[model samples]
Target: MNGCCYGRPTRLPWGVSFPPSSFAGLEFGNAKIHPSQLYFSLAGLVVFAFVWAVRKRTGPAGTLFWISTMLYALVRIPLDFTRAYEPETAFLSAFGIEIVESQLSSLAIALFSLLMIMRLRRESLAPSAA
Candidate 1:
């Protein structure tokens, strides 16, 4: 998680080109971009800190995980727009989709957040005597 949140964004500029060669036709320039990985890493750290603060205040089981996941999803969804992506890549074209790594990560985080939320709700509703 930290690698994805910190490394990808920073390392990409050294060699990785956006809109990759697969989409050579697309207009792409070698512009020094922001270090998004660092941003994501900081975001993760903030979420971690928030979760740590709320761990005792929140309920049991997956509460922290769910909340963190939701926060990550929310942040990633918008970050996707800022990151470069190749719309013509096999991964994107496979399902007639146009999504980048950030978008995919956001989707996964959202799904996990939903699942955790449901689990937390279920646990809360269960009989205490059981």
Candidate 2:
């Protein structure tokens, strides 16, 4: 079910394309993906390496997955600001502060991953069963 989850359509001089029927959802009638997706993809790889290195220093533990997620959110939210967005994109709000849905979702993911990492660190530091 890979619907149009890229969040926004791209308007670059050289953008991407999808078969009209291939995409089940397209409010903008554009065939290309957001140009920022390129940035996100490349940054994602860098973040993966960074998270891997950090996890190695931290411990060969279960928190790498959580760490990766947090790092990805850190990478995405900022880039999203520069991405071209259509009018129909869903948004999330807090106390009259309105933010794009994906950005807010990224924040939530980062927070949760941070919590998981902290909890896991605490557990790892605790004394093992005798």
Candidate 3:
């Protein structure tokens, strides 16, 4: 998908050009668009670096996984805004906030992972039952 941004010309790997009418009213017309795939790839590398760096310092057994998951979602939530996507057709769209399906899924995953991390931390810190 193409995102609107003013920059140097983008070279599509497919080596094909679309006419102005090719894209359903998007009007790309050989215009440069944000390289969303590259951005996502870079974000993934960054997330991996951060998670790997802190792996040994996590609070509990499952905390690292949850932390990494939440971190990825946090990154994805903002990253999705940079990409062109269909807005969710729900009641929230009525409020004028354009949220995509990926963003919604990321938000849910982030929240759930956070809750799990907190629960794991609490369990790790509680008195031992043994």
**1-130, model 1: which lDDT tens digit per residue?**
3222211223344534344332321333433444556566777888889888888877777787788889878777766544545445324544544566667777887988888888888879889984
lDDT of 2 by residue, 1-130 (tens): 3544443555666666545565523454545665455677789989978976776676537788888888899788887774545546648555744467788889999999899999999998899998
Residue pairs whose backbone atoms clash in candidate 1: none
lDDT at 104, model 2: 83
Residue 111 lDDT, candidate 3, scale 0-100 = 99
Better of 2 and 3 by TM-score: 3
Cα misplacement distance, residue 91 of candidate 3 (Å)? 7.3
Q: Which regions of candidate 1 are displaced past 4 Å?
A: 1-30, 89-98, 101-105, 128-130
TM-score pick, better of 1 and 3: 3
The most accurate candidate by TM-score is 3
What's the lDDT for candidate 3?
0.70
Total clashes in model 1, counting residue pairs 3 or more apart in sequence or in different chains: 0
Backbone clashes in candidate 2 total 0
Superposed Cα deviation of residue 67, candidate 3 (Å)? 0.7
Candidate 3 lDDT over residue span 11-110, tens digit each:
6553233445544224455665555666778888998999899989988898988988998899988876555543343324645567767778999999
Candidate 2 structure, TM-score to reference: 0.65
- lDDT to native, each model: 0.61, 0.70, 0.70
